[model samples]
Target: MLMEELPPEAMLDGPPPDADHLLQRTLGTVREERHQAVLRRGRITAITSTFMVAGVLAGGVWLGHGPLVGGTDDEGEVLQGTSSAGANMAVKVTETEGGLRLVATVHGVPDGAACWLVVHTKDGRSFTAGSWRAHAGEVTLAGSAMVRAGDVAGVSVVDHDRRPLVTAG
Candidate 1:
């Protein structure tokens, strides 16, 4: 029955049956057209699905985990360096969301003023992080950038305080 939906082959075994010849011709043409339309629709659907899948894959790749930079702190063994955070510079690193969050208490920067966080990995990979302006007591740096595995994550300021400021713990 499904094959009946398809157009018959052009080759006839012998002389073509004369029964309803014209009607059969019309039906054949219509059937062939319907089959062609179905095929075209199927191709379009396949193409659309492929594109959707590709988009999801590309997005997943782009959303891959960011490199993490973290080190174990012993508090006492670590050196509490001067804050690059300016005046009342008090930089605190806390464990939040399985990542080290750098929070600073500075006196100079005003609310809405942009502040840049410079981070460095153990492999010497350094990059600027998402900016955070002074909000209330401190500015929150981005939390998504993970601390590199088996390495220390260092943080500093730009053009303000370059004092190798890291409290080694």
Candidate 2:
């Protein structure tokens, strides 16, 4: 084989073999790709957060209106009463497992007055449902009676001294 050697000046010839432009192009492409990746991550995070908030709101609505939290409608029979002393009482009676449940809303009674709820049965017997201390505005109290709801002939509220405050049948 024949060997030929080029002069050193030939290597240093034209544009100094520029590589800065190639390096800049490579760096610019890498920077653009990084920016695009960051944008994609931000978009994904925003979408996921929106869905999570929507799901939480839907669950809250379902819980609020569901039967587990008690339906919106009032249940049982409602009775009203007003006494000569100007006291008023409203009672809602519902039949329960072995007796009757009562929710009473009493008004126009003196504050801090001890009151009792008495239930009279059709069989000529009286039963005390519960008692409480009256407060301002409408006072709501809950009680239960051993008698069935249908057997209740009347209901009354009395003071600690047994003076009738209100009565309803």
Candidate 3:
């Protein structure tokens, strides 16, 4: 009879066939390649996401409008005030066509207390930027001074008695 006419059991009555081994090897290779491809795609996706987040943060900083990154100070310097009497303050000095632009923030100051901004220069000169009474909460003050660049040594927040409530540089 022909090989095709043999019974199903007769077909496996010898040593394990070479065809089965080859098929198994081929299947294993295919599975491994598929797994590797999946891993590669995952890694690529992770890297791409990280880059996207970094780009967004950089853009926000460049725009000069984000938490911890406000008002452009490219042409000036930023000074942080030391907390005194339970109040915190910060100052930013920016150069303008007329002179210097001063921006100040005071927080936790005593309510209704008179507070003044003092700008001290490195050349033994001092100028009062502005003054205001603190509110129940935080307060922001702005002013301008006709001072030269690189001359400002520090800034101070003083009470009505001229006692420095907080100083910063």
Please name the candidate that would achieve the greatest TM-score relative to the true structure.
2
Select the stronger candidate by TM-score from 1 and 2.
2
Query: What are the Cα lDDT values of the candidates?
Result: 0.52, 0.84, 0.81
Clashes of each: 11, 0, 0
Tens-place lDDT per residue, model 3, 1-169, is: 5988988988676766697898899999999999999999999999999999999989987654322223345646779876746778888888765567889988877788888898889987889999998888878899767786578888888899988888888
Candidate 3: stretches off by over 4 Å: 1-74
**Could you tell which candidate, 2 or 3, scores higher by TM-score?**
2
Per-residue lDDT over 38-98 for candidate 2, one digit per residue giving the tens place of the 0 to 100 score: 9999999999999999999999987643341122326678889998878899998877655
The local distance difference test score of model 2 is 0.84
Specify the poorest-scoring 10-residue window by lDDT in model 3: 64-73
* The candidate that achieves the highest lDDT relative to the unseen native structure: 2
Q: List where candidate 1 sits over 4 angstroms from the true fold.
A: 1-21, 24-36, 47-59, 66-110, 120-127, 132-169
lDDT of 1 at 103: 50
Q: Residue 68 deviation, candidate 3, in Å? A: 23
Error of 1 at 46 (Å): 3.4
Superposition error at 57 for model 3 (Å): 33
Instruction: Write down the TM-score of every candidate.
Output: 0.34, 0.55, 0.54
Residue range 1-169, candidate 1, lDDT tens digits: 7767766663457565785797799999999999999999999999999999999998887555323234333221111234444433445554433545555444445455556655567777755544555555644344324554235455554433433322221
